[model samples]
Target: MNAIELLCKARKAKKEARSEIPLHHALEVRMQERGWKIVYYGDEAGNRKLASVGLSDFSKDIKSFAFRSNTSKVIAIDSRMPAKNRRHALAHEIGHIDLKHDLAHLTSGDEKDAERFARLICTDGTIFKRIAIYLFCILCLGFGIYGSVCIAATDDPNIQQIDVSASPAVNADEVVHFTASGEKYHRPYCSAIKGRSSFATSIEDAEKNGLEPCQMCHPDIN
Candidate 1:
């Protein structure tokens, strides 16, 4: 079909639909209504299945193709492509069906017509397409903000880093150290604690516990 004919056909079909659906899904339903099976394959396993039933030597270069199965016509598309390309390819294959091209013979004479059909159907301005475009923009914005946050975390010199291996802050004058069995408290590193396994407490706590300063370490000097 020419561009105008294709557009009219698509618009007529859209007006007949009970409700709106995604363009790709609507295309699948369009083909399905004619008893055609649509298969979207991505991985090697899916490719293998399509190869067995449809094109055995699938050119990785092409995105989609159509074939006549024993029971019904089948359309196969490469799912690895981005959603937009995948839809375009599927629509292109559907274009072949709608245009009544010889699927088995496969000729290039009508390639342009099929391409036009795909473009018209995909770009024909629908509420679903508008919503999809808006959602895609939102997703891109979210990723941009997340990526900016990640970059700032890695590149900003102002971000503080904690030295987990360093010792905690301590006020020497406010704290005193004593051994588990000792009767007196002394400053850390005092001679009295040089060979002792000591613990620490506040100076007031030590004094309240009836502990005195060690004379040998001159603990009271601090």
Candidate 2:
């Protein structure tokens, strides 16, 4: 999916911090939410040597930037920026993080997404938009396909030859499979049902069909 789609569907960054809220408090809350840290160019008013830290260019004027340091994400906002610009910068960096853009390889598309996200937060936002964002998230996460691991069929006594191609648009790795005659559905590679005459369906569907999960596989399709 695209960046915007991911933002709308997946759990990215929290964008509901109101404009009226204190930007510093918002920043602190946001940073804490993601286990992130914020810092200035200088510590105790001294320049932090950030040549290899993030995407900042000391030579050019920068509003704000985000980068990974060790095991944490850090957002660096220029101390010189005014209140308005600082808020934008905070949203911008938070945008980069929510988009999951690669700091090592910044791209035009990434910048555009960050800009869009920042503009969205910096301005007076609507509750409907925020609700819409998570509404899509619920639909996607609740019903979308999630197949990250491959399942292989094995020779088993209870089952015969397997044919995943019999089903359309179903990957053998992704969905739970079970025979209509059986009382239980199973992971595709489940020994009890592998190499058997079976129909593929999601775990949710299997349960809806009143099929219990197989004891051998302990199906966890998500």
Candidate 3:
């Protein structure tokens, strides 16, 4: 199987997020729906940090990574990572676990698949296309037979119901002011809060920076 094939399989499994939803919640919901648990704790067999990897040894280059088993473990994303990166890392690791190639002990090819999976789930088509194209080139030139093998074995029957909301298109320097309509509050998830004065384009951005969603608005939930 090639990257396209892997992606086609993933798509067939209904794994794509909604076209425009915020990447963070879209990904988290998808992960749970697909049976990959998410947690903030650090004791899982895999951990997140400067980089994400599969512990199943799917790729030799990785010092560590997550693997697929009936073990019922959390994705173990690094709680301390920047919010944007933490979202991608967790999704990438979930790709590895979902692909189930770790049992074969193949590395690079699986890593590529995982990356591709991450791209598909966590990004827009423009970005996903770039990563997929790169993987196709590497698949043909780099791993040869092993690459083909890894691709062939990648399949799962899970899909995500993503919201498909566009990431806010705003200049970073734009002064985004909020009005506290009755002491507005936004709660995105188990952590973080938001207020009328929050200047972020999105609640997730605020939470990533260690701020919570407005308790009244609950931007994270929407």
Candidate 4:
């Protein structure tokens, strides 16, 4: 499948799941509901990383993997990664599962489509909006095809980040903030958090605790 087809499949699966929760939580809940088990590396045998899951060389880079057998499907994630990254990895694996991508039989083209699909779903904004941006980029060739991919994948930080002055506070210069219920981290003055309950925290602390970047008031994605 191509990027558009993959994205359409993802949207269909998301609609059918219908958990009324965050995308990550909903995906996990749907997997469990379907009898698929999600486990961490330490939960199973061996103290190794992705190696224990049959991805030895990818141990350092891959965040998760999915395995399927005649009777069951299992997704395993690297517990050592930050919470936000772990969530994205899990969602990506879930994308493979939901889209029924056969790992054993996947072609190079299929693999690329799968990765692009996962990135789209894991992105902070709505799928429709992102797709619109991707299509617009394709039309405006001056931006380049790679630029289009970056937009769809949420890897273009320059486009995502907005400059907003920090709200007045003693620690405003040193701390970033995020809503208790949001995955996006933000600068103190971000209008996105204007009326919401938010907490001020250092970037290091926010990252260590696993908050993700805000699409509108982009903090670091990493």
Best by lDDT: 1
All candidates' lDDT scores? 0.59, 0.56, 0.46, 0.57
Which segments of candidate 2 are over 4 A away from where they belong? 1-20, 42-61, 127-222
Please say which candidate is ahead in TM-score: 2 or 4: 4
Clash pairs for candidate 4:
none
TM-scores for every candidate against the unseen true structure: 0.49, 0.46, 0.45, 0.50
Please identify model 4 stretches exceeding 4 Å from their true place. 17-19, 43-62, 125-128, 135-222
TM-score of 1: 0.49
TM-score winner, 1 or 2: 1
Q: Sorted by TM-score, highest first, which candidate order results?
A: 4, 1, 2, 3
lDDT of 4 by residue, 84-173 (tens): 787778877777766677856766766655665566666654544445345434433432212112221135554563222223333446
Model 2 whole-model lDDT (C-alpha atoms): 0.56
Clashing pairs in 2: 42-46, 160-195
Looking at model 2, report the run of 10 residues with the lowest lDDT sum: 159-168
The runs of at least 3 residues in candidate 3 whose Cα sits more than 4 Å from the true structure, single-residue gaps closed, are 10-15, 42-71, 103-108, 141-222
Error of 2 at 155 (Å): 66
Colliding pairs, model 1: none
Identify the runs in model 1 with alpha carbons over 4 angstroms from their true place. 1-3, 13-19, 52-54, 126-222
